[model samples]
Every structure is written in C-alpha cells, then in structure tokens.
Target: MTQLTLDTRSISRGDGLTDQAYKVIRDAILSRRLAPGTRLSIPELSRQLDISRSPVREAIARIEYEGLAESVSHRGAVVVEIGLDELVAIYDVREVLEGLAARLATRAADDAFIDVLERNWQAHRDAVEADDVEQHMKLDAAFHRHIREGSGNLRLSENLRQLQGQIRVAMTTTVARRGGMPAALAEHRSLIDAIRGGDPATAEQVAREHITRLRESLHDAASAERHHNNERRKP
Candidate 1:
C-alpha cells in the first residue's frame, strides 16, 4: 500500500503554474468554498491567490473545458451550478465509468490492492462513527480514486478525477441535508464487496444503484433548500 498523502493544499504545487491555479480553484469549487453559481473574476482571484491574472485566466479556461465553469458573454467566468437535470446526467455517466473502473480493477487487482481498499473502507467507517463529515467525505473521495487508479487505465482514472470535482459538490450538499454518514459507509462496503467478488455485472449494478440513491438524496436536499429560501424571502 502506497502511503497516501492526503494534503490537498499541496496538490497544486507539483503541476505547472496554470495547472496549479486550476487545481486550487477547482478544489475550492468542489469543497463548496466558492459555491455554485459564484462569478469568478480573474482579477479578484489573482489578487486573492497572490498570482498574476494570466495564470488565473488560464486556469479558468481549463475549468471551463471541464464543464465546472462557463465563459459568460460579458460577465466573465462563473461556476457551473448543478441543476437537477445536470445532476442526473453527471451521475448517469459516473455509473457507467465507475462501474467499468471497478470491473477492470477486480480483474487486475492483487491481494495488496484489496487490503488497501479494506483499510480505506475501515477508515471511512471510523470517520462516520466519529461524526466527522469532512473526514468522511475526504476518505470517500480517496477510496474511489484508489479504485480508479487500481483499474490500470490511465484514461479512465483521468476521466474519473475530472468528474470527481462535480460529484463532490453534490455529495457535500446531500450530506449537509440527510446526515446519513453510516448509510454512505455501508454503500462503500457493498461496492468493495462487489469488486472483490470479481462479478462485473454485480459491480455495475451496485454502482448504478449507489449513484442513483445519491442523486435522489441530493434532489431532496435541493428541494428542501429551495423551500426554505422561499419561506425566508416571504417574511
């Protein structure tokens, strides 16, 4: 098992300047620090991050390509808000790609890979038990990343990493509403079991079901948020 360094702060340092800026901004978006629909001003970002506008502009362009941001006609770049429709579309794609990754991982993974997964699963369970939502989310992301890498497909891993940013936002929103960390842990366990069993069909089925449940939960949260905001606005 490789020593997993979970320092998200330094994730940007290893890449090029523009790439590093992109990751930093992307991480903020994923973690909801930037929030959905937030307008990203290049000058503002450059000042905040103590970098030049050129790199920030480059970063925004890359993020736009990833569908995490959009280039407005005159308003500049803005974070892409995940609507119910986008949520369904993204998860549908995730189900297929993640299931394929799991299937490939099962065929290629050795006992060590399984052990690493089990350890990650246990850590996730512990985080849930402790009611540490942040840690739980981080572990959950790591666990999926491990599976993608273990799949031995560079393209699959890259695609999953890109998609992961969007998924994180939805996951964070859902967790904030439902408060069901234990259920999420159980789902992870089920996913691991299906992969370990070497049953591609079962793996795909479970993956889709898990993502579908997540989408439903997020939809419920979004609806509740809308209702709450409406009431607040009334009086």
Candidate 2:
C-alpha cells in the first residue's frame, strides 16, 4: 500500500522518533498517499521507518485523536472517511470559530504577526502562480495558523489546531473538484486586509464568508459527483 512507502528522509533528524513517525504518517494522510480506509499496521510502519513499534503506536494514537484515523474493531487503525454531511458540519462550526478568531486577531495582531501574514500571502501567491499545489496547501494552512495564533486565545488556537487534521483530509479529498484556488486566494487577501485595517466586524465577516464559500463549493462537488454516478447507473 502507498502508506507503507514511507520516505524516511522526510522526517527531520532533529525531532524525536515519535514525532518523526507522526509527521511521516500525518503527511501521508494529508497528501493522499494514504487514502481513506487504508490500514495503518504498526509492524509495517515500524519496519519502513526502521524504528520500534512503540513510537509508531504512539503516532497512530495521536492521529486517531486528530480525527485522521479511527480504531477499527479488529483492524486496529485506519484512515478515516468524512461523509459530505460530516464535512459540512465541521465547516459550520469552523466558520463561526474562525470568524471569531479573525475578529479577535484584528486588534490583537501586532506588527510581527502582520509581517508574517504578509510574507505568507506573498509566498502563497507565488505557489499558486507556479501551480505548486502542495506548497499552496501548506501555505494555506499556515495562513490560518498565523491568524489563529494572533488571536491570542490559547484555547481557540488549540481547538482549531485539533480541527486541522480533518481540514487537511477534507482539502485533499475535495480540492481537485473544488478547483477555485484563485478565488480562495482572493478571500485570503480580503481577510488579510480586514485584519490589517483592525476592523473586527469586517474581519469576522470576511473569514466567515470565506468558509461559507468553501462549504458551498464542497456541496457543488458532491452534487456533480452524484450526478455522474447517477448517469453511470442509468444504463
């Protein structure tokens, strides 16, 4: 299976073995190298990473907590599949929380964080221009991370951080069908402007609107997929 094909080089030597194992497995899920329902075998992963099963087990436990994987009855852990309803539900809560984060960040964000946001925006634009989808995905997450951190609410930041695994899974599974990178970038730009202007209401509005549009796009994709499946069944 693709999940078994771990590239050890990707794991940073500076981190602990468990963190290294966690990152490799997590990246595989986010990058779709390990598609939904793939079984994550501890022995197999340990063999590939040339490490003991202890860290690999710990990593899988963490992935489970992050909602990327689940403990099957007898199958141990497997990558999770998010249905359209659940996906929409996640975004529903995210829209409100992210809106609040942006609202709080508007006044709380300092020059350094703003500078980081600006740099991230520029890098994200470059990634899009170059058609580097992987880099763009990373930058997209970074943009949100920076904003949430700037909110100065540790609880909120932790909450969003927990949501990230599912968010990444959703993005990977649906991004191809969504196909509106430029539109997303524009929304990010608007969000940046609102935060920079220190306009709490505008910032919240922009952030909420951004997530709402994403939810809409997912619905559109699901409809199209259903239509295609129905056409196939018509014969």
Candidate 3:
C-alpha cells in the first residue's frame, strides 16, 4: 500500500486543471515522492487532488506519453523505472547538446546574464554546504536552463528540457550512490569562468568534459554498488 501524497490546494477552478494536475504529478515523480513503479490511479488521484477524474486521466496519459510512466498488465499506469544504462544513454546525448548550449551562451550572453550565472553559482554553493541533495539538483537544473536559454536557441532549449526530465527520473533512483557533487561544483565553476571570459570554445570543451566525467562517475558508482552487493551476499 504505497500512498501518494499530493497537495489538494494545488489545483483550482479555471486554472487549466489538466495542466495543473500534470505538473503536480510530474513534480512528484521528479522529486521521487511518488517513486519508481508506483501505481497512478486516476480515481485515487482525482480524489486526492479534489478534481474531476477526466483531468486526472488526461494528466496520466500525458505522463505516459512523456515516458515518465508506463502501462503494466492489470496494474494500469505506474511511474517508469530508469536504470543506470538508460541514464548513461541520456547523458551521451546531453553531453553534445549541453556543449552546444555552453558555446552559444558564451557567444551571446551579456553582462546581466553573467551576473545571473554568478548568483546561481553562489546559491549552488549554499545548497552543497547544506548537503541538500534535492535543492542541489534543482539549482543544478536551473543553472543549465539559464545557459540553454541564454543560447538564444529555442529549439535546443526545448530538446534539453525533454532530456532533463528523463535525467531527473533516472537520477532519483541512483543519486544516493553518486558522490561526485563536489567535483561537479568545481566543473561548473570552470564552465562559468569560461563563459565570463567570453571563450566559447573553452566553455564548450569544459561543458562536454564535465558530462563525460559524470558518465564515468555513474559507471564507478554502479561498479561500487555491485561490489557491495556481492560482499553482502557472501557466506
């Protein structure tokens, strides 16, 4: 009996109930509050959200279409379970796209955007100090979003957004095992310095290398987990 806790006050009349429901459910999934493979029942969600079943159904459908959830035999829809291999695959594409974003942002960003990046970096430092993984994840996404949006390429930003959603799903499952946050912070500092220096090539290179390091970190984490599991199973 897995309970899905949702804030009922998040939905309101004439507020595009379907979209609202979708956002609420999506946030829950990303936050791992709903968790992987948890059943998403339309009736239950409607009751909890205090909304009509129709909107809830539509929201679930949209989530399924986004690959966030899938239909199982006799179980209706459940949150999708992302594995390490899938996360690595997503990072492969993300590396290229994010590199391009960093290059373009460096070329096009103004002083105001540089200031924003500095502010974002400061907040990220605070999150790391507090050891708030969730807040750190949020700030990390915001930091990337700022760069992609600064790239002045709407299509690229949209594609990255889709990829980011999948990344969030995969990350929630293995984030505990991944212990490269400090390394990531240092890499981000390097990228920001490149961006501030107006060096597009350096920015792109640093960004791509950062992602490569992250992908490697995933392999290291998975390997360590396997070793731990093997030790635990020893007689």
Candidate 4:
C-alpha cells in the first residue's frame, strides 16, 4: 500500500473533518493519483491526514457509495478496480445521458453557451497538443459538463455527474493505453459542430459515436494492460 501525506493546515473547522477528508480522498481517486486496487488503511490515512479515524472511516464510506472504493472482509478499504463489465455498463449509461444532454442543450442553448463550449473544446485540443494527459482529462470533463449544464435540466445534470465518476475510472485505463489526445479532441470538435448547428439528431448521433469510440479504446487498453501484467507475472 502506498501512503500519502495530507496537508493538515488545509483542514478547517468550518466544513467538518469528514467532508474535508472525503474531498481530499475523492480528488486523489478521480485524478488517478491513487490508482485502482490500492489498499487504504484507516489508521495510516488518519495519521497522514491528521484526523481522527472516525472521520477517515466516514470519508471512506462515502467513497464506497460513490463506487470508488470497496470494503473487503479482511483487507479493509481499497480503491475499486475497473472490470470489463463495469466499463461497458458505464459507457452505455454515458451514451444515453450524453445523447439526451446534447439533444436538450440544442433546444435551449444560446450563442454564449455555444461559445463557452467551443472555448473549452479548444482548451482540450491545446492540452492534447502539449501531451498533458491530466490537463486533457480536466478539459474534456469541462466540455461534457458544459453541455450538461446547458441542457437546462437540473436532474439530468445531477445524474450526469454521478455517471461521470464511473466513466472517469474507465478513462484512466484508456489513457494508459492510447497515448494520444488528438483523436478525442477531434471527436469533441465534431460533436461541438453538431450541437452548435442546432441539429438535435446529429448532436445525439455524434455524442453516441464519440462515447462508443471511447469505450472501444478503453477496452483495448484494459486488455493490453492485462496482457502486460500477465507477462510480468511469468517466470
């Protein structure tokens, strides 16, 4: 197990310990700083974060609810691993919600909204050019989130946030396999054009296709990783 030192000074009395701990752990998990299957020790985490084990335990419980961590009988809490079935399921959900978000966003988005989307898409492209996978992930997330917000459906937006957590895990696997960002950025550009043109059908089609391609790329990457790991284990 890898240990991380949390900044105690960053912890404040305002939001309570659990919330602060939750945010710290959640961000690490999402950003892939804490990779999947990493065993989490409450005592070690409590000492590192300079908090009580109760709050650390509470934070871990919330992570479990978010599907980012799992509790084992004797192993305690560990970051959840992305299985093939889980990956497929997550992409399937994204395809539906993203398609709906694009369709709804087209119905109500103003020129300003489109402009924001375009700017975010450009940022993603720039990140890709720089070969900054982390920045590319952040910008890519921003682009999709912008669409969800522009959709004008609060419930849909909330649902998309929940769905995004699962998709992010799969994305980490994909990034490990496919090292380039141009193809994904180009797909984003295509989707943006469809949405900006106010063509709901085209927007939906593009969104679906984009997610489908992501799913395929992630699957290939995961398979390759498995093969590599298997080879490493061979005598």
Candidate 5:
C-alpha cells in the first residue's frame, strides 16, 4: 500500500545488450505489464523485444535474483504472484523500513530538501482538492520516495526500494487497497510536519502510524470482499 515505488524510470536507450534486456524486462515487471504468474518465455520474449535469447535468459536470471521472478521446474521463469497474504507481508516489512527512513531523514535532510517535501505536500493537497486521482496517487508516491532517498541511508533506501519493486503489484492491483488514499493524505501531512520539525521520534511514530492506519483500511476491505464472495458462492 506504500510504494508502487513509483519513479519507475525506463531503461535508457543506450546500454549494453544484456543490461538493456535486463532493464527493459525489469521495468515491464515493475509496471505490471508482465503481471504476477505470467510466463517469461525466453524465446518469446526475445522475439518480442527483437533481441537474442541469451540476453533474455540473462535478464530472467537477474530478475529472479531480485525476487521478481522464479524459475519453475518446467515452466521456466514466471513472475511472482501477489495475494492478500503477500500484500500484508510486504506492508509489514515496509512499515518498519519506512519508519526508519522518516526518522533518519529528519536528522539528515537539509532545509532545501524539506522545502521539496513541502512543495510535494502542497502538490498532493492540490491533487486532492481537484479530485485528480492519478496525480494525487503520483504525488503520494513521490512524497515517500523523497523521504526514503533523503534519509541519507543508502543501504536502507536500496533495500526498501528493492523490496517494493518486487512486490509492487500488491499496491496497484488490489481493490482492498483502494480505500486508503483520502485519509492517507492527511497522514502524509502529519509525517511531513514531523520531519520538518526535526523530531525523529515524532517523525518515526507518525510515519509508522500512517502506514498502520492504511493497513487496517485495506485489511477490512479485503475481508469484506472475501465475505461477499463467499456468500455469493453459497448454493
């Protein structure tokens, strides 16, 4: 429910064949163009990208290491499927990681960086006011992205980024995760204030609470959906 990790940069045009293949495929997976459990047929992918099979295979190997794909016995590599259980698991990890990111960013972020957070906050507010769902979502995503990167902890940033990248489907696809945004924006405002105030304790608590709040919303929604489906299926 936090990242979709947004800022998904495409593979730049100029790069080595293997790296290019890897990036292209990685981006596709992150963007959900290649959905969970979809087959990654090397020869098919090679033809689609108009590249050789070797590079495609190499790309599969890299993504598998990143937890985006797994090699099945005969099915070859397939994208990882994200269900509610997986979604909750990811949010569980992310809430803690994001709390640390906010706490660290309070100490490390400069005024200029805080200015960026303020600007992003205003933009997000505008998006909410205008009822522009896409822009609101993008700004919401960028808000956390700035905090994570601004944390000045490279290892923490990279670890969260990777965890998010591999499981981003949970962010985009589930209906249960949909109802948290309006309230989440208010929580974002609190987090921004905490960071700007340079209180790491408040920042971490606010950050963790923000995520925990959304987690409850999504869980209730998912439970409702399952109950509805079960009732409808009853003969």
Candidate 6:
C-alpha cells in the first residue's frame, strides 16, 4: 500500500473544516493513496490533521453517502473496493454521458469555459512531464469535470459528478497504469481543439471515441480478471 497522506494546505483554504476533510480524504481514496479496503480511523485522521473528530466523522458520513466508504461492523469506515461489474457499469454510463457533455459544452462554448479547459490541460501536461502520476490523475479527472460543468446542462453535470465519485478508482487506474498517458493527452488536446473550434459534432465524436475505447478496454480487462478468478477457485 502507498503511503497516502492528506494535503491539508489544499483543503484548508476557504471551505469548512468538514468539507476540507471530506475532500482531502476523498482525493486520497481516489488517488489510491488511502486505497480500497483500507480501514479509516476518525481519531487518527483528526490527530494527523490537528482537527476535531466531529469534522472527520461528518466527512466520513458524506463519503459513505457518496459510496466511497463503507461502514464495516466493528471495523469503522473502509474505502470501497470497486469490482469488475461496477467498472463496466461505470464506463458504460460515463462514455455516453461524457460524450453528451462534450457536445453540450461545444454549444456552451465561451471564453470562461474554454479557459478552464486550457488551464486544466496545461496542469495535466505539467503533471505528465514531471512523472507525477497522482497529480496527472487529479488533473485528468478535473479535465472531464470542466467539460461536464461547461455543458450548461445542470442535470447532466450533477449526474456525472455523482457518478464520477463512485467510479473514481477506475479513472485513477486507467491513468496510473502507464503507457497511455501521452495518447490520452493527445486525445484531450484534440477534444480541446474541437471545442475551441465550436464544432459540436467533432467535439462529440472525439469525446465518444475516447470513452468508447476506454470502455471496451475496461470491459475486456474485467472479463479477463473474472475468468482468472474463476479458474483459481475451481482448482
């Protein structure tokens, strides 16, 4: 397991302590810092952050509601481990909805939204250049999020936000696995160019193609893993 510590500086700004704690813990879980199935100790986190247990407790509750943490009997909260079926389900839904977001974002194109995308893309490039996989994954997630929010479709944005939290591990895994980062970045650059050109059709097409490929890959990987598990169990 990687030693994933909370970045208190990022969380400490502006937001309430509980929200800060929640985001910190959530990012750790998403970045595979805290990792799946790791036991969470409220008192421990509180001690580490020099904060109170109440905020940590509240953060855990919010995390639980978002399906990122599970309350184990006598074991406290543990990060949720995503299974094969959930990975497939996540990519399936994400491909369609994210494509829709890209299309809608094209329609919503303006200086402000485009700025957010460029900034995120630049940050991602820096992360990749620095070989900081965790920061790269964080920017990758943010890159998708900007498109969703820029879509001007409130419901669509909200839905993806909920769904992304649930399947964050998959996104992290996809980027962290290596060898695909540059290709993914090129795809995103293409996406940015399409959106900047205000061509909704091209934007949507590129977005769909990117996600569809990922979905298929994840599906195949999951299937293979499940098969291996079954074989092991039989022997």
Q: Which candidate is the best by TM-score?
A: 3
**Would you list the clashing residue pairs of candidate 4?**
none
Q: Higher lDDT: candidate 1 or 6?
A: 6
Supply candidate 4's per-residue lDDT for 20: 92
Task: Tell me the spans in candidate 3 whose CA falls farther than 4 Å from its real position.
Answer: 129-132, 172-179, 223-235
Candidate 6 residue-wise lDDT, 1-235, digit = tens:
3344777776563449998898889888876788788888887888877788999999999998878889999988998888867877877888889889999999989988888889889988888888887787678888998899899899999888878887875443665333567767888999999999999989989998888777776777788898999999994
Q: Worst ten-residue run, lDDT, model 2? A: 171-180
Q: Write the residue-wise lDDT of candidate 5 on 1-36 in tens digits.
A: 111121224434345767887877788787777777
lDDT of 1 by residue, 101-144 (tens): 88888788778998999999998888988889789878988988
Error of 4 at 210 (Å): 0.5
Let me know the TM-score candidate 3 reaches against the reference structure. 0.87
Find the candidate with the highest lDDT and give its number: 3
Better-scoring candidate (TM-score), 3 or 5: 3
Model 5: lDDT of residue 67:
84
Which residue pairs show backbone clashes in model 3? none
Residue runs of model 6 more than 4 Å from their true location after superposition: 1-15, 115-138, 170-172, 175-179
Query: What is each predicted model's overall lDDT from 0 to 1?
Result: 0.77, 0.85, 0.86, 0.81, 0.77, 0.83
Instruction: Pick the winner on lDDT between candidates 1 and 3.
Output: 3
Evaluated against the true structure, the overall lDDT of model 4 is: 0.81
Per-residue CA lDDT of model 2 for 157-187, tens digit only, reads 9888878778777653444545566767888
Task: Report per-prediction Cα RMSD to one decimal.
Answer: 6.4, 2.9, 2.8, 3.3, 5.0, 3.7
Could you give the candidate ranking by lDDT, starting with the highest? 3, 2, 6, 4, 5, 1
Best of the two (2, 4) by TM-score: 2
TM-scores, in order shown?
0.79, 0.85, 0.87, 0.81, 0.83, 0.78
**Model 3: ten consecutive residues of lowest lDDT:** 171-180
User: Which regions in candidate 4 have their CA more than 4 angstroms from the true location?
Assistant: 7-9, 170-180, 220-235
- Which residue runs of candidate 5 sit more than 4 Å off their true CA positions? 1-15, 172-179, 225-235
Instruction: Please give the distance, in angstroms, between residue 153's alpha carbon in candidate 6 and its true position after superposition.
Output: 3.5
**RMSD in Å for candidate 5, one decimal?**
5.0
